[model samples]
Target: MARFYCDACKEEFEHSSPSKKEYTDSFFGCCWQYVAPCPQCGKECTEKKEPQKKKRTSSSGGGCSSGCCGSCSCCG
Candidate 1:
Protein backbone atom coordinates (compact mmCIF):
# COMPACT_ATOMS: atom_id res chain seq x y z
CA MET A 1 0.00 0.00 0.00
CA ALA A 2 0.99 3.60 -0.57
CA ARG A 3 0.08 6.96 0.91
CA PHE A 4 -1.36 9.75 -1.25
CA TYR A 5 -2.21 13.37 -0.60
CA CYS A 6 -5.20 15.04 -2.19
CA ASP A 7 -5.11 18.79 -2.77
CA ALA A 8 -8.83 19.07 -3.35
CA CYS A 9 -9.80 17.07 -0.30
CA LYS A 10 -6.91 18.41 1.72
CA GLU A 11 -6.37 15.02 3.29
CA GLU A 12 -4.15 11.99 3.06
CA PHE A 13 -5.38 8.62 1.83
CA GLU A 14 -4.02 5.14 1.39
CA HIS A 15 -3.86 3.24 -1.90
CA SER A 16 -3.53 -0.47 -2.26
CA SER A 17 -1.97 -0.33 -5.70
CA PRO A 18 1.81 -0.43 -5.63
CA SER A 19 2.57 1.80 -8.62
CA LYS A 20 1.06 4.99 -10.02
CA LYS A 21 0.09 3.31 -13.25
CA GLU A 22 -1.76 0.56 -11.44
CA TYR A 23 -3.47 2.99 -9.15
CA THR A 24 -4.55 5.27 -12.00
CA ASP A 25 -5.70 2.46 -14.21
CA SER A 26 -7.65 0.84 -11.41
CA PHE A 27 -9.40 4.07 -10.50
CA PHE A 28 -9.45 6.26 -13.64
CA GLY A 29 -8.94 3.64 -16.34
CA CYS A 30 -5.88 5.46 -17.70
CA CYS A 31 -2.14 5.25 -17.10
CA TRP A 32 -0.55 8.09 -19.08
CA GLN A 33 -0.90 10.73 -16.40
CA TYR A 34 1.45 11.01 -13.46
CA VAL A 35 -1.11 11.97 -10.84
CA ALA A 36 -3.78 9.66 -9.55
CA PRO A 37 -7.25 10.64 -8.45
CA CYS A 38 -8.04 10.58 -4.79
CA PRO A 39 -10.36 7.65 -4.08
CA GLN A 40 -12.28 9.69 -1.53
CA CYS A 41 -13.04 12.81 -3.62
CA GLY A 42 -12.09 11.75 -7.14
CA LYS A 43 -9.65 14.64 -7.30
CA GLU A 44 -6.05 14.69 -8.47
CA CYS A 45 -3.71 13.17 -5.90
CA THR A 46 0.06 12.84 -5.57
CA GLU A 47 1.95 10.01 -4.02
CA LYS A 48 3.55 10.75 -0.67
CA LYS A 49 7.20 9.85 -0.42
CA GLU A 50 8.41 8.63 2.94
CA PRO A 51 11.38 10.41 4.45
CA GLN A 52 14.65 8.50 4.25
CA LYS A 53 16.34 7.54 7.48
CA LYS A 54 19.82 8.89 8.21
CA LYS A 55 22.60 6.59 9.28
CA ARG A 56 24.03 7.25 12.74
CA THR A 57 27.64 8.43 12.78
CA SER A 58 30.11 7.49 15.49
CA SER A 59 31.69 10.36 17.43
CA SER A 60 34.69 8.31 18.56
CA GLY A 61 37.93 8.41 16.60
CA GLY A 62 38.49 5.88 13.83
CA GLY A 63 39.46 2.40 15.10
CA CYS A 64 38.16 -1.17 15.48
CA SER A 65 35.83 0.03 18.26
CA SER A 66 34.19 2.35 15.75
CA GLY A 67 32.88 -0.68 13.85
CA CYS A 68 35.19 -0.16 10.87
CA CYS A 69 37.28 -3.27 11.48
CA GLY A 70 36.94 -6.60 9.61
CA SER A 71 35.43 -8.32 12.66
CA CYS A 72 32.64 -5.76 12.78
CA SER A 73 31.62 -6.57 9.21
CA CYS A 74 31.22 -2.86 8.48
CA CYS A 75 34.17 -2.61 6.11
CA GLY A 76 34.03 -5.53 3.75
Candidate 2:
Protein backbone atom coordinates (compact mmCIF):
# COMPACT_ATOMS: atom_id res chain seq x y z
CA MET A 1 0.00 0.00 0.00
CA ALA A 2 1.00 3.63 -0.55
CA ARG A 3 0.12 6.95 1.00
CA PHE A 4 -1.40 9.68 -1.11
CA TYR A 5 -2.03 13.17 0.15
CA CYS A 6 -5.43 14.47 -0.81
CA ASP A 7 -5.51 18.14 -1.57
CA ALA A 8 -9.27 18.09 -1.36
CA CYS A 9 -9.26 16.86 2.21
CA LYS A 10 -5.84 18.25 3.07
CA GLU A 11 -4.89 14.90 4.55
CA GLU A 12 -2.91 11.83 3.64
CA PHE A 13 -4.58 8.54 2.82
CA GLU A 14 -3.42 4.97 2.37
CA HIS A 15 -5.15 2.37 0.30
CA SER A 16 -4.60 -1.08 -1.16
CA SER A 17 -5.26 0.14 -4.67
CA PRO A 18 -4.32 3.74 -5.40
CA SER A 19 -5.20 4.93 -8.85
CA LYS A 20 -1.64 6.19 -9.36
CA LYS A 21 -0.20 2.78 -8.70
CA GLU A 22 -2.89 1.16 -10.75
CA TYR A 23 -2.08 3.52 -13.57
CA THR A 24 1.59 2.59 -13.41
CA ASP A 25 0.79 -1.09 -13.19
CA SER A 26 -1.47 -0.87 -16.18
CA PHE A 27 1.57 -0.38 -18.40
CA PHE A 28 2.52 -3.98 -17.58
CA GLY A 29 -1.06 -5.16 -17.52
CA CYS A 30 -3.47 -5.63 -20.38
CA CYS A 31 -3.26 -1.94 -21.29
CA TRP A 32 -0.24 -0.27 -22.81
CA GLN A 33 -1.23 3.12 -21.44
CA TYR A 34 -2.71 4.04 -18.09
CA VAL A 35 -4.70 6.83 -16.46
CA ALA A 36 -6.78 7.35 -13.32
CA PRO A 37 -8.15 9.97 -10.93
CA CYS A 38 -7.59 10.55 -7.27
CA PRO A 39 -9.74 8.67 -4.79
CA GLN A 40 -10.30 11.79 -2.73
CA CYS A 41 -10.44 14.53 -5.33
CA GLY A 42 -10.57 12.60 -8.58
CA LYS A 43 -7.75 14.80 -9.84
CA GLU A 44 -5.84 13.58 -12.88
CA CYS A 45 -2.43 13.66 -11.29
CA THR A 46 -0.68 10.31 -11.74
CA GLU A 47 2.85 11.07 -10.57
CA LYS A 48 3.85 9.24 -7.38
CA LYS A 49 4.70 12.30 -5.39
CA GLU A 50 3.38 13.90 -2.27
CA PRO A 51 0.44 16.18 -2.97
CA GLN A 52 1.15 19.84 -2.55
CA LYS A 53 -0.24 21.55 0.50
CA LYS A 54 -3.08 23.64 -0.79
CA LYS A 55 -5.66 25.07 1.55
CA ARG A 56 -9.00 24.06 0.15
CA THR A 57 -11.28 27.09 0.44
CA SER A 58 -14.24 25.60 -1.39
CA SER A 59 -16.90 23.08 -0.49
CA SER A 60 -16.61 21.01 -3.63
CA GLY A 61 -13.83 18.97 -2.12
CA GLY A 62 -14.18 15.77 -4.08
CA GLY A 63 -13.27 14.94 -7.66
CA CYS A 64 -11.57 17.28 -10.11
CA SER A 65 -12.45 20.44 -11.91
CA SER A 66 -10.85 19.61 -15.24
CA GLY A 67 -14.04 17.79 -16.27
CA CYS A 68 -12.19 14.55 -16.81
CA CYS A 69 -13.33 10.92 -17.24
CA GLY A 70 -15.75 12.16 -19.86
CA SER A 71 -14.77 14.47 -22.69
CA CYS A 72 -11.12 14.17 -21.64
CA SER A 73 -9.30 11.21 -23.18
CA CYS A 74 -6.70 10.79 -20.46
CA CYS A 75 -8.22 7.42 -19.61
CA GLY A 76 -7.17 6.18 -23.03
Candidate 3:
Protein backbone atom coordinates (compact mmCIF):
# COMPACT_ATOMS: atom_id res chain seq x y z
CA MET A 1 0.00 0.00 0.00
CA ALA A 2 1.13 3.53 -0.74
CA ARG A 3 -0.07 6.98 0.31
CA PHE A 4 -0.91 9.80 -2.11
CA TYR A 5 -2.34 13.29 -2.08
CA CYS A 6 -5.37 13.50 -4.39
CA ASP A 7 -5.74 16.91 -5.97
CA ALA A 8 -9.08 16.21 -7.61
CA CYS A 9 -10.74 15.52 -4.32
CA LYS A 10 -8.48 17.88 -2.42
CA GLU A 11 -7.54 15.17 0.04
CA GLU A 12 -4.95 12.52 0.92
CA PHE A 13 -5.73 8.91 0.10
CA GLU A 14 -4.17 5.47 0.04
CA HIS A 15 -3.91 3.64 -3.29
CA SER A 16 -3.85 -0.07 -2.58
CA SER A 17 -6.70 -1.40 -4.69
CA PRO A 18 -6.52 -2.56 -8.27
CA SER A 19 -6.47 -0.03 -11.18
CA LYS A 20 -3.59 1.84 -9.60
CA LYS A 21 -0.92 2.55 -12.21
CA GLU A 22 2.20 4.54 -13.05
CA TYR A 23 3.03 6.66 -16.05
CA THR A 24 5.66 9.13 -17.13
CA ASP A 25 4.76 12.56 -15.83
CA SER A 26 4.79 14.87 -18.84
CA PHE A 27 4.00 17.82 -16.59
CA PHE A 28 7.23 17.24 -14.73
CA GLY A 29 9.22 16.32 -17.83
CA CYS A 30 9.44 12.51 -17.65
CA CYS A 31 9.42 11.64 -13.98
CA TRP A 32 7.34 8.48 -13.52
CA GLN A 33 4.36 8.92 -11.25
CA TYR A 34 1.52 7.11 -9.58
CA VAL A 35 -2.03 7.57 -10.97
CA ALA A 36 -5.07 6.48 -9.01
CA PRO A 37 -8.58 7.43 -8.01
CA CYS A 38 -9.46 9.50 -5.01
CA PRO A 39 -10.59 7.03 -2.35
CA GLN A 40 -13.37 9.31 -1.17
CA CYS A 41 -14.54 11.19 -4.30
CA GLY A 42 -13.53 8.53 -6.85
CA LYS A 43 -12.13 11.19 -9.15
CA GLU A 44 -8.97 10.28 -11.04
CA CYS A 45 -5.99 12.04 -9.51
CA THR A 46 -2.20 12.14 -9.71
CA GLU A 47 0.00 11.66 -6.66
CA LYS A 48 3.67 11.76 -5.88
CA LYS A 49 5.09 8.94 -3.81
CA GLU A 50 4.84 9.52 -0.10
CA PRO A 51 8.07 9.62 1.84
CA GLN A 52 9.08 6.41 3.61
CA LYS A 53 7.94 6.16 7.18
CA LYS A 54 10.49 6.24 9.96
CA LYS A 55 10.49 3.11 12.06
CA ARG A 56 9.39 3.44 15.67
CA THR A 57 12.04 2.33 18.15
CA SER A 58 12.91 2.62 21.79
CA SER A 59 15.36 5.41 22.54
CA SER A 60 18.06 2.84 23.27
CA GLY A 61 17.10 0.48 20.42
CA GLY A 62 17.78 -2.79 22.33
CA GLY A 63 20.86 -1.54 24.10
CA CYS A 64 21.49 -2.02 27.81
CA SER A 65 18.51 -0.98 29.94
CA SER A 66 18.57 2.18 32.01
CA GLY A 67 16.07 0.86 34.57
CA CYS A 68 15.64 -1.50 37.53
CA CYS A 69 16.16 -4.74 35.55
CA GLY A 70 18.95 -4.66 33.04
CA SER A 71 17.82 -7.89 31.38
CA CYS A 72 14.08 -7.05 31.35
CA SER A 73 12.68 -6.38 27.91
CA CYS A 74 10.29 -3.80 29.37
CA CYS A 75 13.10 -1.80 30.84
CA GLY A 76 14.07 1.17 28.73
Candidate 4:
Protein backbone atom coordinates (compact mmCIF):
# COMPACT_ATOMS: atom_id res chain seq x y z
CA MET A 1 0.00 0.00 0.00
CA ALA A 2 1.17 3.51 -0.86
CA ARG A 3 0.15 6.63 1.05
CA PHE A 4 -0.96 9.73 -0.81
CA TYR A 5 -1.90 13.25 0.24
CA CYS A 6 -4.83 15.21 -1.23
CA ASP A 7 -4.37 18.96 -1.22
CA ALA A 8 -7.99 19.65 -2.16
CA CYS A 9 -9.43 17.89 0.88
CA LYS A 10 -6.27 18.26 2.99
CA GLU A 11 -6.26 14.60 3.89
CA GLU A 12 -4.02 11.57 3.57
CA PHE A 13 -5.15 8.40 1.81
CA GLU A 14 -3.80 4.96 0.94
CA HIS A 15 -4.22 2.64 -2.00
CA SER A 16 -4.61 -1.10 -1.67
CA SER A 17 -2.55 -1.97 -4.73
CA PRO A 18 1.16 -1.47 -4.11
CA SER A 19 2.58 -1.75 -7.64
CA LYS A 20 1.74 0.87 -10.22
CA LYS A 21 1.46 -1.77 -12.94
CA GLU A 22 -1.18 -3.72 -11.06
CA TYR A 23 -3.16 -0.64 -10.12
CA THR A 24 -3.05 0.76 -13.64
CA ASP A 25 -3.84 -2.56 -15.28
CA SER A 26 -6.85 -3.08 -13.03
CA PHE A 27 -8.23 0.47 -13.47
CA PHE A 28 -6.58 2.45 -16.25
CA GLY A 29 -5.37 0.06 -18.87
CA CYS A 30 -2.45 1.10 -21.16
CA CYS A 31 -1.87 4.42 -19.36
CA TRP A 32 1.52 4.39 -17.70
CA GLN A 33 0.91 7.55 -15.64
CA TYR A 34 -0.98 6.58 -12.51
CA VAL A 35 -2.40 9.22 -10.15
CA ALA A 36 -4.65 8.06 -7.39
CA PRO A 37 -7.82 10.01 -6.71
CA CYS A 38 -8.76 11.15 -3.24
CA PRO A 39 -11.70 9.21 -1.83
CA GLN A 40 -13.02 12.25 0.03
CA CYS A 41 -12.94 14.84 -2.78
CA GLY A 42 -12.19 12.69 -5.85
CA LYS A 43 -9.26 14.93 -6.80
CA GLU A 44 -5.84 13.66 -7.87
CA CYS A 45 -3.63 12.84 -4.88
CA THR A 46 0.16 13.21 -4.76
CA GLU A 47 2.78 11.52 -2.62
CA LYS A 48 2.93 12.84 0.94
CA LYS A 49 5.69 15.29 1.83
CA GLU A 50 6.59 17.55 4.75
CA PRO A 51 4.27 20.50 5.01
CA GLN A 52 5.80 23.93 4.45
CA LYS A 53 4.73 27.10 6.24
CA LYS A 54 3.34 29.84 4.05
CA LYS A 55 4.72 33.36 4.36
CA ARG A 56 2.25 36.06 5.32
CA THR A 57 2.34 39.59 3.89
CA SER A 58 0.45 42.70 4.94
CA SER A 59 -1.57 44.61 2.36
CA SER A 60 -0.15 48.02 1.45
CA GLY A 61 -1.95 51.26 0.46
CA GLY A 62 -0.99 50.74 -3.19
CA GLY A 63 -3.61 48.00 -3.55
CA CYS A 64 -7.09 48.57 -4.92
CA SER A 65 -9.51 50.62 -2.87
CA SER A 66 -13.05 49.70 -1.86
CA GLY A 67 -15.55 49.22 -4.74
CA CYS A 68 -12.68 49.13 -7.26
CA CYS A 69 -12.91 46.37 -9.85
CA GLY A 70 -9.13 45.87 -9.66
CA SER A 71 -8.66 46.43 -13.44
CA CYS A 72 -6.37 49.47 -12.87
CA SER A 73 -2.72 49.72 -11.82
CA CYS A 74 -3.72 50.31 -8.20
CA CYS A 75 -4.68 46.67 -7.96
CA GLY A 76 -1.19 45.64 -8.81
Of 1 and 3, which scores higher on lDDT?
1
The residue-by-residue lDDT of candidate 1 on 1-76, one tens digit each, is 6678888788888877534343346666746533567877787677877799999876455555565534455544
TM-score of 3: 0.40
- Clash counts for all predictions: 0, 1, 0, 0
The number of the candidate with the highest TM-score is 1
Which should have the higher lDDT, number 2 or number 3?
Answer: 3
RMSD (Cα, Å) for all candidates, in order, is 9.4, 17.8, 8.8, 10.6
Roughly what TM-score does model 2 have, to 2 decimal places?
0.29
TM-scores for all candidates: the values are 0.46, 0.29, 0.40, 0.40
Q: Number of the top candidate by lDDT? A: 1
> How well does candidate 4 match the true structure in TM-score terms?
0.40
Error of 4 at 32 (Å): 8.5
Off by over 4 Å in 4: 18-34, 49-76
Residues 46-76, model 2: lDDT tens digits: 3346558998453343334454443445434
